[model samples]
Structure formats: C-alpha cells, structure tokens
Target: MERPGWAPPGVDITTPTSSRIYDYMLGGSHNFAADRAVAEQAIAAMPHLPAVLRENRRFLGRAVRHLAGEAGIDQFLDLGSGIPTAGNVHEITAGINPEARVVHVDIDPVAVAHSQAILTGHPYAAAVAGDLRRVGDVLAHPVVADLLDLDRPVAVLLVAALHFVPDDATAGAVLADLRDALAPGSHVAVSHASDDGRPPAGLRDAQSIYARADSAVTMRSRETLDAMLRGWELVPPGIVACPAWRPEPDDPPSAHFPGYGLVARLPHPA
Candidate 1:
C-alpha cells in the first residue's frame, strides 16, 4: 500500500481499515492497497459485495434527502461516517437545504482528514474524530452543539457502519444516550448488516478476515435491531432490508442487501 503522508503514525499499513475498505467497496479511489486487499478478499467471498455497497450508499442519499425535504429537518449528525466520496451527507443535504447543518464523526483519522479537506469552506458542516461509544463526549462536543440545536429536530445517520459495534448492549446504550438528548421531532437513520438470508461459507470466512483488523462484523436480526429503536416512533417500512427501505421509485427491487435501514422520530416529552 502506498501510504499517505497524513496517516496516523505507527498505524499498521498491512491491516485493513473498516472505513477504507468501505471506500473501496463503493468503487472510490480513496482507499489504500491493504484496504483493497481485504476488500477484494471479501468480494471473493461474496461477488455481490460491491453492488451491495453502492446500493447502501444510494440509500443513504435517499434517506438524507427525505429527512431534509419531506421532514423539514435542517440539522444532521452522521456517525461512523467513512471516507468521503461522491454524494456524501454534506453534499446531499446542502444541495437540498443550503442552510442545513451537519457534523460528521468517525474513529478513522483518514476519514476525518479527508472530510476536513473537502468541507473546509462549508459553513454548515464540520467533522470530528471520536469514538462512537463515547456518546456523551460526542454529543457535548463544541462544534456539534454550535452547529446543531439538540432541542430541535436533527437527523442522526448511522449508515453501513454499526456492524463493527459487536457488543449488543454497548451499541444499544450508545444509541439510547443520543435518543435521550434529542428533542421532539428528531430522527435517526440507521443501516446495519445482517445474516437474514441463506449465505455461503465464504461470506462467513470473509467476516472472519475483518477480525484481524481490529474490527468485528456482527450481523444482527430484524427483531434485535428493532429493539434498538424502542423509544422512537418508526417511520413507515420500519426496519426492512436496505434495498427495500423507501427506495426511490426508479430503483430496482432487490431482496438481498445484507443490511437494514430505518428512520425513527423521537416523541416529544410531556
């Protein structure tokens, strides 16, 4: 892998990064050779991996547009946001509502640096590097509070990234903290991978490969994922497979994206 000058010191160039692999899966050029190597191995396990990644990205765009346009949401917090690529949250949201505010958060330094480079002049957007498990700090971060009023509705997007959250309790608690802080009308859009349908042995093998990279691929079931949204009101088509989540009228129907996408609105306090 041709290492970039910006990569964190002592970072293992031989190890695959979840975000970088995701970037590669989306047919983006921002990833390195190590990321490509692991991603290619995953593709070998499931030839449709790239297609699934693209479909998920399209779903993210569609979900953001729906919240901004149809739901009148003007603020967003994108968690575990991977390396910036075409049709990112800022690009899609700003295109719809020029005044929309967004905070992009990720544990990946590369992702943060790339986001900063692309969004420097964008008055409505900012990026932060933080652990998603630290829900308190992430929500209390100065930039997030400055750009977004938690007392008002904001869209929190967790797309194609939560699978690394292997511990169910930790994942649920992190989400609950955010839910507790949101005001009435706030929304959360999440997409998580699952082993809902029959899968070959190779896909499981591919998931194992990620364990060597300090990441875990934990695929959940619909019921378990729905449990994560307990306090919020579900939008129509609640917790369906990714490709089926309010897909654009023009998008082809597919039953196997290995992930689920759902948007839920927080109810107002009495």
Candidate 2:
C-alpha cells in the first residue's frame, strides 16, 4: 500500500497488510492507497466483503456486551486486535461496565504504536504487541498481568483474527494455552472466515488475494472450529453466520454471510 501522509514514520507502505485492508473495508481513513488496492482485489472476489467485515464488527460488539452484562465478566484479553476502530472490545465492555479492564494484543508494530498512543493513561486499557502463537509470552506480559485478573472470569475476544492462523496445529496450541490460563467461567468469543454454506469454488480468488498479503488466510470448516472448542460449552445459536449469531433489530436480513461467530464458556471440571 502507498503510504498515506498521515501514516507514522518507519511504517512500510508497500506491503499489503491485513489490518490496513480491514480498515479500508470498514470505511476508515487510516488505510493507504496500496491497502485500498488490495482491498478492492478482495472485493472483486467477494462482492460483499465490506458488508461482511461490518457484520463481523457488529457481532464483536454484541459478544463483548453479552460477556460484560450477562456473564459478569469485566476483564478482557483481545488477541490479534487490528487497528483500533469504532466499537472495539474495550469500547463495548466499558460501556457495560466502566471498570472493565482490557488488554489488546497484536503483532504489528504499527498497530502497537497506534494503540499505545490512543490507549495510554486510559487506566482500564493497555495495548501490547505479541504474536498470538506465542501464548506463553502473551500470558506473561506485564500489561496483560496488570490489567486482567486471570484468577477471575475474563472474556477472550478473537474477532476476525484467528482465521489468519494458517496451520491447525499452531492454532490449536495457541487456543489450548489460552484455555489453560483462563478461569473455569471465562468466556471465549470468536468470529472466523468460513466456506461451509457456500460452494467450494467461491473462496479461491479471495484466498489468492489474501495469499499476497502480510498474513495468509485460513478458512476453516465448522468441524475444525468445533474441535478447537473442545472444553468450552457453546452458547445459544452455536456456530452460525456472523450476522446471524445475534442480529440487531436494525440489521438487514440476508443469508450471504461469509463468516461464523459464537460465544462459549469454559466448563468447570467435574
């Protein structure tokens, strides 16, 4: 992506980034021309790319609010948090409980810098840079330790991020590590790209476009995703279309969804 004048120094503008492309899809001004170009390529493959991204964001808000309100969860650990956008995990949770503490994690240095600048001194929020694959490092981070109390229930938000984890082994290892650290009552909410309800040929071009980006895309099957939730008890609706997880009254009725979302809780050992 061509660097925008507003972009900070030292950030690469040529490489196509998932975060930047996501920002573009969300109608944000933070993306560059290079990002927009790649995003258009994706849109060409999937006409509803923008709408799908928005639906995913909306689902994220609903999941966070549900965790904060119904589950009495006030601590959050958001992995692979992209560039901060409207109605992020912290925003949604804080709205429900002002005392809620959130730690946003991502591997992008640019994202870390941006998050730091915006969330610094917010008291309840902290931004830390780390690969989601490095579960040990993420859990051991001082920011995470200081903001989130692992002994109590917490909400782990993995919105539109985990699908980027290419290998099943790597993804499972990361999830297992997180599950081990979370309390018995902790909730895990995730939204992942999928091809379950569509023809197999529908995802080829989209996958190709993502292959050219900074991160590779991994569209998992429902069975694969379910296996990843081995110990957690699924909430109502189970794994369904992102928009269908819990649609708002104002949401348009459509079945052309591109992702799956669900909220689940860790079960106490018998």
Candidate 3:
C-alpha cells in the first residue's frame, strides 16, 4: 500500500489503524482499504458494530454538551480523539459557548492531520499528535497549553478511546495522572466497550479483528469501568450503556450496544 500524498509523514498506510477504522465506522472518509476491510470484518461478526459506534459518538456529543451547559466547563481536552467527524467536541461545546476551547489529541498522524485541516483558521480549536498514555506529553502539548487554561475547569473526554489502552495498570495510572493534573472543578468523560451484553464468541472475534489494527481493543466490565473513574463524583444515571446516558426523548433504545459511558467531576476543594 503506497502512502498517499495526503497521509501524514511517519504513518504506515499498509497497517490498519484504530483511529481510521473508527472514522470509517462513523461514516467518515479518512480511512484506507486496510482500515475498511478490518472494520467490515468486525461489523460482519457483530452486525451491530455500526450502531455501537454511532451510539458512542452520540454519547460524546451529549456528554460534551452537559459539561458545557450544565457543568459550566469551557475548555475540553479530547484524548485519543479519532478523525474529526460530526459533533466534534469543539462543535458541540461551541454551540453552547462559542468561546469554548478544545484541544484534540491522538496518536494517529492521519487523524491529527485531518483534524488540523478541519480546524484550520479556527482559533479556539486545534489538534495535536500525542499518545493518551503519555499524560504529561498530551497536557503539555503546545496547542493544548496555548488554548486551554489548566487552572480552569476543563472537560477531559476519553470517549471510545481507553478500550485501546490494553493494560489495566497503565490505563489506571494514566487516568490518575490526568485526574490529578486538572483543577478541582474539572470533569472526565469516558466511554468504553464492555463485554456485558455480547456473546463471548462474537466479542472474541471482534477483538481478534481489532488486534490486527495499530491499537488492540480491550473490553472491560462495568465494575472495572466504574473503578477507572475513581476519585471523582459520577453524575446522575451513572455508568450506563451508551444511549442510556442522558439520552434524548427520540434517541434509539440502547438494547444492543455493548458500551458504557459516564462523566465524573473532581470536587472543588473544601
């Protein structure tokens, strides 16, 4: 697979990437044949994979809106933010408050490139290439530091991203570092794939397919998801399925989605 001129430098276009595969699942065009092939295989195995991805995306929008409107959060750090698609963090928060700042971080060079292109000339939003596990590198990124004030309440979004971490201890430590770095009023919104509602065989197949991608998938139990958000106060309707989290009246039922979402806040100091 020859690299296209549009692809960012240092990216291997031949191998499937989680970010690009996710973009393809969300109906975005930044994916290659390799990514689409893997995504299609997962979809074939689970049939409801597209719906699950859509639900996850919708959860991201709803969570961001809640943070901007109800929680009074004006800045967002979207970690492992995939290819820029509909209802991006900045777009959702900007609707609530135009001046809201967003910093999108991803390990994928292609995702970063596409996001940078999409955010061109937009002063309040920017994208940076960084690993989510490297909490310090992500937070200290020039674009993140310039746009988001760490002293203020910022919403950290890990929507559909942490499942790719593949290591419990590393993921836990990363979350802890991020939690401790923010101000007292900051919020962390997370959505992770879960093995609760799916058949073991199908889930294993899906995981096997994703394992070939640049990042492997690791589905967690609901209890483990809850534990990941330790030290924070969970908002109402805590740690429910994707669509079950603050769903709108017309939102589709979440009967088939095997993902969980929650938004928790670090309490203000006494």
The best candidate by TM-score is 3
Models 1 onward score TM values of 0.95, 0.94, 0.96
- Candidate 1 vs 2: which has more lDDT: 1
Steric clash count of candidate 1? 0
C-alpha RMSD values across all candidates: 1.6, 1.7, 1.4
Candidate 1 C-alpha lDDT tens digits along 191-212 = 8888877864466877887666
Local accuracy by lDDT, each model: 0.85, 0.84, 0.88
TM-score of 2: 0.94
Where is model 1 more than 4 Å wrong at Cα? Answer: 6-11
Candidate 3: list runs displaced more than 4 Å: 197-201
Model 1 RMSD in angstroms: 1.6
Q: Could you tell me which 10 consecutive residues in candidate 1 have the lowest summed lDDT? A: 197-206
Write model 2 residue lDDT over 1-270, tens digit each, in one string.
Answer: 365565678888788789888988998777777778889988888787787788888898888888999899999999989889888877887788999999999987777777888897899999998998988899889989888888999888888888899999888777788788888999899999887765434466977887788898898988999999878899998999888887889877775676689999998999
What is candidate 3's lDDT per residue for 1-270, written digit by digit as tens? Answer: 666778978778889999999889888889999999999999888777887788888898889989999999999999999899877888998899999999999988899999999999998999998999999988887878899999988899998889999999888887799888999999999999888864534777888888999988998999887777778889989988888899988777765667789999998877
Better of 1 and 3 by TM-score: 3
Candidates in descending lDDT order:
3, 1, 2
